[model samples]
Target: MAPRPPQQKVVTLTDPKAIRALAHPARQRVIDELYGGSVLTATEAARLCGLTPSAMSYHLRALEKWGIVVRDEAGEDARERPWRAAAKDLRIDHSGHGAATTAATRAFAATFVAPLVEELLAWAGSDRRGQLDGTSMSRGRMWLTTEEAKALVDQVVALMAPYEERTAADHPEGAAQFSSFWSLMRRPEGSAAD
Candidate 1:
């Protein structure tokens, strides 16, 4: 296969309301399932996640209220309302959420990270583990001016763009769901010259 193109940074909402809306585990799973090209009814989604139909319905309603998922009007069944994700990818702006992290936010982050760790372990057990062969994994200190830091982030984002776009479609039949979490943090202790 040919190489994928660079990704475009597309983060629609930078508001606390949107971030809080997606903080729930059930809602996040709904987003994941729908993003995989499955416009499913409440019952179908509930079965997929082992949730009760009524519980799934409540979560679906919450997602709809937040404009993250929308009813699939193109479907024919009136009793069964199918839904799809509003965006193919979501980027949460943590800047305005406030300095102090709430228990709810921390819990949500832990829930999200747990599944990711599980998947990485499972992936390592499989034969395709060699796919990470050429990939580099390391941490190091860096000193960069404001412009240089921004440019570096842009470059990394660009490189990951195409893979992000094709992530859902690239999975084979009966493949387990995989989640990718990308984050960049800057500490105050380090100066630009550091």
Candidate 2:
């Protein structure tokens, strides 16, 4: 068979309505499931998410309406339609709106973070401690100038570029899913030192 087409990378949110559509949890779950190059039917997705088939179908439709996912016509079965994510990265520009925008952005961030938290917890609980053993983990407060802060963010983004490019390939079989979560928050000027 011919190779599958490369997945599209999210550039910008041209439509605010699409962003709003993805604000729902169930729809976000659908997006996450289809992220790692998985083409799944609504029934299959529902079973994975522990939801009724009809309910999962509804969310899948919402995702399709938002241009976040597309249906695969190659699948022969009409009863089970395969779906894939529309983009590899979800880009949301928060420079426009006020309070509502902030809330929406937070909701979007939470949608992605929740799954990672669960996965990390599961890994910690597993008997195979070797995976996490000898791992280097660090958490601390840092004080940096405005320019320095921007440089730090750029460095982190550059570090993750290679891994992001790998998932774009057609990996049909089971493979390890790795994710790196980076968060940076700076205090206002004159804030108390730690």
Candidate 3:
């Protein structure tokens, strides 16, 4: 038999309605749970987000309509249906939207990212001797032309392929999932600090 096709890893959301729907705090939490490889039922998502099952069902339906998540047939039965993330990453372009979309996008990102930021800070504050080895965070700034910026993103995405392809079974002993967050952008005018 032929080799299986590679999965679509990133999905771009261009509709403002869809973006707004995804900006809900509880919905983002449900998406997070699914993205972390848990095939979750509405009840499970509800529990994770501290919402009623009916409420989570509504949010999951909205997410499903936007193609952010899909039913996992393999993990479902008559009693319950499970949902999984449609892709490994979701992208929203904020270039041309008005204040509302920008605000919604910011709300979505802030709610989604706050936990990760807290996690990093906790890791940083822990005693080095008792903390996990080989974990790190780095920051830098550089000026580049628009074309060069696009090329840099392309290169990094290519580098991520191998790590993205691995399954839980492929993970080595003592290995755990690591979250890598990156931000690249032009400095705003009148910025004083580098």
Candidate 4:
């Protein structure tokens, strides 16, 4: 049978609390697993993250409280229910929300990018270039009006959103999960943070 199309959707987070809650690394591990279409029990997630099952269960409950993950039906065992990612994507849009929201969004962005950065560091320190073939680093500089930047970003997101939601089973043979990170910033007069 042919692979199915992605069930593309995004849950946009504006609540500062939710954004902060999701900044936890353990929770992100669960999100990544679920994003790859693996419905997991807390124990399974714990195993994947090298945490105790009880600790993992606590993290799962926290995510469930925020509606970031939902419980699926029990499989063969009546006691172990699986969890699924609430949506294909979880996005942060705290702009214009004030200081707390801004801080939470900053933390979320850092948390989201940290693991990918570690992967880059790993590649840099390793000699597994052949094993990691097709991995790449890209850089580009562009000058565009604010409106044009927003439009371009929206277009890119729209184009990739569907692909981002594809499940492990939806991929071809020998497929692996690929991590990606991108940032767009304008050149600032004095501040490099821009």
Best by TM-score: 4
- Estimated TM-score per prediction? 0.68, 0.70, 0.80, 0.82
lDDT of 4: 0.78
Q: Report lDDT (CA) for all predictions.
A: 0.65, 0.69, 0.75, 0.78
Candidate 3 TM-score, C-alpha based: 0.80
The residue pairs that clash in candidate 3, if any, are none
lDDT (0-100) at residue 186 of candidate 4? 68
Range of the 10 consecutive residues with the lowest summed lDDT in candidate 2: 1-10
Q: In model 1, state the lDDT of residue 89.
A: 54
Estimate, for each residue in 17-43, the C-alpha lDDT of model 4 and write its tens digit: 888888878888888888666788889
Stretches > 4 Å off in candidate 1: 1-11, 97-105, 124-141, 167-179, 188-194
- Candidate 4 at residue 102, lDDT? 81
Which model is ahead, 2 or 3, in terms of TM-score?
3
Please count the clashing residue pairs in each candidate, in the order shown. Answer: 1, 0, 0, 0
- Best of the two (3, 4) by TM-score: 4
Q: Rank by TM-score, descending?
A: 4, 3, 2, 1
Local accuracy of candidate 3 as per-residue lDDT tens digits, 1-194: 11122246877787777777876778877876676556778998999999999999999999989888887764425578777778776677767568777877777677767767777787768786366566777788887989999899889878976676554545578877776676677788889774
Between candidates 3 and 4, name the one with more favorable lDDT: 4
Best by lDDT: 4
**lDDT of predicted model 1:** 0.65
1 versus 3: better lDDT goes to: 3
